[model samples]
Target: MTDRPNPLSDLNARSREVFRRVVEGYLQSGDPVGSRTLTRTMSEKLSAATIRNVMQDLEYLGLLGSPHVSAGRIPTQLGLRMFVDGLLEVAEIGDSDRETIDASLESTDHDVTNMLDHVGATLSRITRGASLVLAPKHETPIRHIEFVSLGADRALVVLVFADGHVENRVFTPPPGQTPSSMREAANFLNAIAEGRTLSDLRSDIAGELKRHRQEIDELARSLVESGLAVWENAGESSERLIVRGRANLLPESDEGAELERIRTLFDDLERKRDIAEFLDLAEQGEGVRIFIGSENKLFSLSGSSLVVSPYMNAERKIIGAVGVIGPTRLNYGRIVPIVDYTAQLVGRMISDRTKG
Candidate 1:
């Protein structure tokens, strides 16, 4: 496999310090940073000439940019990536923050969807930016399956997995099928589909139908097909994506002609498949992964930053990802830990629920 290239290389101590301060300042104020400003704000007592030389070295390294020659320097994409990877200092979650997170987790009921939604909204409020939560795609192995007919051609298919997870889908029976037919279909499924994943069961449903023709009437076969199709459609629909705090991105006039960029971003986010794929990438990494500016193709045009972490179940399977999105000027130092802590808390909740 080709290795990913490092964003920063060959910076000495002094140059790294200069680049770090400039990037931190730019992230704070969303402005080009002058050498004099760094000399004043940074704790180290570096001379303006020395800072300017370091800035020049950074610019040469493609880590810093000067929009106008006279203006101060700002961290380019390379600079932001470097700072995030190395110099960024994450603030620890304070007692109050922990209390708030615990309260949110404890107050919720057993509904995973509700818990994930609350997590997304809380993250958005905490970061003062938009948050995204991509929930699990329901990949657990099947323990048992049940069908409950609601009459009038509608029936509820209740799926129970080995992990004590239950999901339901409603399906319409093929014209004029009786509830007895539905019952026969349900019995046939429970007999043959136990301990199989939904995917496996779906592939073998037709074969089961053919083999059972001696016992099951045509009505039962029709109902079985309907039930299996409903399950397949519901499995396909399990990809859930929740986005909160989009309004937070709109008020920043300084985001430049990126207004349309934000629109495109929202559209892309609306496509759950893309968001799920993006979250899957983040899930492969440890801790929080910060995607700044053009580092990721999905939000590259928007000049956005994504701070993401995976939430996992007790079995250590990643169940989902939760994160914040904002302009590249986001407070990485603060939001990094926030995202990390939130992911951990979410993972804990999922694990606890699964164990219970």
Candidate 2:
């Protein structure tokens, strides 16, 4: 990885200390920090001239910026990244946090989707920011596919996988199909489709129908087309994104023009697809991954930060990701370990479920 530009690198020990103090103070208060504030709050004994010189150096390095000509300096994105990388100290999750997380994860017996929703809500409540949980995709091997008539030319296609997972999709039968034809189609599928993937079965059926004559009639063919069409459509089923704590964004007094930005973020989260895709990129790795402002293309426009970690299965395959999204002033020192610990908890829970 390329090394990041560190403003403090070129400074002496005292100068570096002053620079860090100013940045940390600014991060904590979300305000421009002056030398007087640092002198009062910090033990470092630096002359105001020396502090000003150090701040100027930091500003030149792109770590500190002044919103107004006379205002004190604030940590820019580069400064935040450097401070987060080297200076920030993360506090461990206390016993209360552990208890709360354990209670939330342990007491829930719902399906994966509901569990993710619960996790998102719990995380948002804990962090006071928007929380996100991406559900595991359907990747288990197919065990069987069954089509049941739901009356009025609609059929419910139920898919059973080797992991004992089942999902249902509804399909409308083609123009001239009757209930009898649907049953015949289901029977045909069950007979030849067992132990095969839905995609593979569809391909084989289509090829067979094109190349050779089979016992299946025109009506049965139409039913098969309907079933296959449903399966094809299912392939495009979007990934699930669960978000909570959006209302918290409404109360930020400092974020003026950012209110509209937050509104856009809420709308984007409602779509879920974009966040899912963003998490998919991060889920390819292990442990917690922090994406600061402009680091991830998806949220770069929002000028937000994401702290995400992948939850894995017993076999060590990534199942999903859980994270929090908020402004760059996000308490990374606190949220990083929180997200990491939650991801580990989620992975263990999923592994236990898979075993039992």
Candidate 3:
């Protein structure tokens, strides 16, 4: 790995101390800090004038900004990123929270959708913000496959999954074969595909399509092609995204502008494809990822942030992600470890179930 230059190298000890206090204060209260406040709080008794000079220097460096002409200083998005990356003191997830998460996932009945819903709800309760989970996907096996005629040409292909759910697709048959022949085809193909997943069955179907056969007719051949094509076109059906606690994103204030931002963020979340694609990026990394305001294009307008981590299966391949979404000035030190542990716990629990 290459060593990148540190931007804070130029800051003197006094300036760094003053910057840290300012950012910490702002994170705790979401309010700006005056020099007098820092002066009284510091271990060393520096005069208010000296603290003001350091604050001015930090502002000049673009780490702090003032909302009003004479208002105290608050850390900008850049300052928050710097603090999170270089100076924040992360807290370990408490035993209580860890137990809460673990107990919920202890059962391994394998209802993936319900498990993810529970995971999201747990994160929201812990962090007081919206939670997102990218669901893991695998090759699902089918218990049965049947073909039913809808009309003269259009046919319905039905798939019965091992989980007891059924999926139906409209299969268009080629010209020259009767519905009765199609029934024969469905019976023969069902016998072949009953015990395999669509992925595995596709290969078998491909092999059959490759060779000449006396038992298969034109419509039966089309039925095989179109049935497989439907599942192929379904496109990542096993993997999905689940979000909860959207109402948590809204702050308890009457400020119309902030409320408008929350509304915009809700709209962004409704478009799952954008958020899902962004979460997919976290799979490339090994641990928790922080995307500050304006860093992720999807949330730039809403001025939101995301802290996400990818979870893996027993094979160590990343199968999904877990994350929190909130305002830019998140409680980074406290929340980072919580999000990280949740990801690890989720991966461990899912991997254990898979092993069973």
- Backbone collision count in every prediction? 0, 0, 0
TM-scores, one per candidate: 0.63, 0.65, 0.64
Task: Give a tens-digit lDDT track for model 2, residues 1-356.
Answer: 12766555667776667767777776578788987777675566767777788788878888788999988998887777888777777888767777888889877884666677778988999988899787676766677777777887788988888778898878886667777777788788778766677667767886875454233122223333434211122223332222233355345433322344434543654455565567567777787877888877677789789888999998899978899998888878888888988999988887787677
Worst 10-residue stretch by lDDT in candidate 2? Answer: 228-237
**Segments in model 1 whose C-alpha atoms lie over 4 Å from true places:** 1-9, 42-47, 140-276
lDDT of 1 by residue, 125-177 (tens): 77889998887768677877777779887889898988887888789876667
Error of 2 at 27 (Å): 2.6
Q: By the lDDT metric, which is better: model 1 or model 3? A: 3
Rank the candidate models, highest lDDT first: 3, 1, 2
Q: TM-score winner between 2 and 3, please give it.
A: 2
State the C-alpha lDDT per candidate: 0.74, 0.72, 0.75
Which of the two, 2 or 3, has more lDDT? Answer: 3
